[model samples]
Target: MKQQKGFTLIELAIVLAIIGIILGAILKGQELINNAKAKRLLNDVKGWATLEYTFYDRYGRFAGDGDGDGLIDAGAFATSQANFGANYIPPTSALLTPTTAYQNSDFDAPVATLEAAQLLPAAQNAPQRRTNVTNAFNGITYPASVYIDNVGTFNVIAVKNIPCFAAKVIDSNIDGSIGANVGYVREIDNTGALTGNNTWSCDANNNEQQLVSLVYFFDKRPN
Candidate 1:
């Protein structure tokens, strides 16, 4: 009978080391992938923000009317183009002229008229409503005085405006501790997805929403 052959201890050790290296490489690759995904998501959010601003500029409000009305009518003032434009310009009669309130196709001209003003109060005073554009995600739910904190590692996620008497995010918190009320939650992936336990703070004193971090992924290496 032929003598049985077996791997020497050194050969076995080498094989185990190779396996460990392969596992490490795979983990590193996954980390890189996740990092890239996070960055992409961040970029996507920024792009969305741009679109939102543009929407307000072109149409006089945010993307959609929460009330599902054809026009950005009453109770839907936060995104009104007329209101935001009013806030942008100085008190010049041409810009501030009551007749200038209406520009977007969705709204009728001479929006300054009492009747027009009555149509969309929120849209008219959007600027005075809230400074930061409130995220009106279709199904995202959050508590009051919360906001998405984009600082430190992307470990913490999302934020919200403090619950206020009015339906606005800025006036939501009066104490200015809106930064401390940040919460952390897992990312949402499904329809009507909800993120819980996420940090809700101002972005590094920038007074802007970051929603992401710089070192997206750490210690990544080639597989």
Candidate 2:
């Protein structure tokens, strides 16, 4: 009988183990990248909030709602009046609209006012300001805005990101779980109350989940 040249089972097991190790490393690397992106999103939200507060402190009024009119003052800025208004009230439901073909309207008047007052950089004017920033994890353009709520009691700045992406943001900033009082809220419609639904809320097991696209309002708004 010819001598068998087949390798022993030990060799095969070693190769399989090496492959598993490589796969695990790759998965962990991807998870770290995602977490970094989520943190950046949270930072962006905080930055905008800080800018709003700075504007308020300098001018004694919200950026867009100049003159304390509870509406975006067009004359205060160099943008169109239509692009600046109390359209993003109730922050939970306000959808960011495109001001032109290339840019989404993001606090056009308020940001512009900040620019005009020299509180914000002149380059940070509307039509070119940070309207929609890309989410590194999901490749989605999260639209941001600064506006006063309907009651005129709060100055709200918000970003609309998909539920999963938003969840990452909330988890990093607030509680790690998507439970009630998570410092963020989700709503089905622009006019409805933000309730924890199955789609956006984690199940009783506390697993991260997703729902329809939802807006994530920052808690640092000035009231």
Q: Could you say which candidate leads in lDDT?
A: 2
**Number of clashes in model 1?**
29
| Candidate 1 lDDT over residue span 23-110, tens digit each | 9999999767645544444443344334434534554543322232222221211123233233332222332222233333222222
Model 2, C-alpha of 221: deviation from truth (Å): 8.6
Write one digit per residue (lDDT tens) for candidate 2, span 5-113: 9867999999999999999999999778767766776666566567756756765655555345443342211222234433322221111121211122344455545
What value of lDDT does candidate 2 attain over all alpha carbons?
A: 0.44
What would the C-alpha RMSD of candidate 1 be, to one decimal place? 16.9
lDDT, residue 128, candidate 2: 39
Report how far off residue 36 is in candidate 2 (Å).
Answer: 1.2
